[model samples]
Target: MQFAIENALPMLERTPQVIETMLYGLADEWIYSNEGGDTWTPVDIVAHLIHGEKTDWIPRTQVIMGEGSKTFVPFDMEGHHAVKKGKTMSQLLDEFKILRKENLAQLKTIDITEESLNRTGIHPILGTVTLRHLLAAWVVHDLTHIHQLSRVMAKQYYDAVGPWVQFMGVLGGKR
Candidate 1:
């Protein structure tokens, strides 16, 4: 689908609620389990979303707008591990909701236009990128994790599903 601020905002605004609906008050197994290896748990995904809200998206948008450093700071993809320690899932969800709300409000204040969306910034690793790309990534990033959360949670029933697993595309590694 085409990327527009109007199209993106609704998804962005609903992410917290989506996450909450999927995750809130679940058993510890669903919340804390991972897909093994280095894959993140549902809690980890929420923490990562919180970290992005605090560090990545809006700050980089400002950088593209000439309101901050010319080159964007390197993002720590796994930085959420440290911050989420000793915290409950409810705490992480609450923080993510608050930060996302504030960031969206700040984003709406910017006088965006076609030209502004096309304005550029230097990502420390990805090199030059446009403001439009950053905003689109923010929306898709939420979706990606939402997908991951569902996959991970469903996998919790991998063995329980037994022969039925053949019909479960999520368990088939389609992503």
Candidate 2:
């Protein structure tokens, strides 16, 4: 996709609000429920988001822009959940809001010029990547979790939508 700060900033700015709109004040059943078993709950997704706000986006942006071609730290996807333990889902969402707000504030203070955006960093798995790629991925990452939240919620209606399961790919797929 095109690499423009114009495109990415709004998403970075609005993620917490979108998340709140999707999950604020939801009951524990909705927040913790998932399709059958062995999947992420909305609560888990929020914790993952909180972890990303702290560890992924701006920190990596700084590395790629400032350290150029340096091998970056690998992100621990399955880890970071310990932060969520003992917290209610509402607490998780509120914490994400604060963290995301702080990150967006930090992101705005940085100088993300075309040159900076073109700067590259070595990835442990995906090989070399650029700041442009990271920014784009950040937006897509938010979208992915939003879709995941929707799918998880939709699954609560899986049986209600009986025959439509064939048509509703979200309820049918192993997301």
What are the models' TM-scores? 0.95, 0.91
Per-residue lDDT tens digits for candidate 2, residues 1-175, read: 6769988888878888888998998877889898776899898899999988888888888888674547778888876578689998778878898998888888888888888888888878999899888889999999999999999998888888877788888887433
Name the best candidate (by TM-score). Answer: 1
Structure candidate 2, residue pairs in collision: none
Flag regions of model 1 displaced more than 4 Å: 173-175
The lDDT for every candidate, in the order shown, is 0.92, 0.85
User: Which lDDT tens digits does candidate 1 get at residues 1-175?
Assistant: 8789999999999999999999999989899999999889999999999999988999888889976567998999989998799999999999999999999999999988999999999988889899999999999999999999999999999999888888888899433
**By summed lDDT, which 10 consecutive residues of candidate 1 come out lowest?**
166-175
lDDT of 2: 0.85
In angstroms, how far off is 139's CA in candidate 1?
A: 0.6
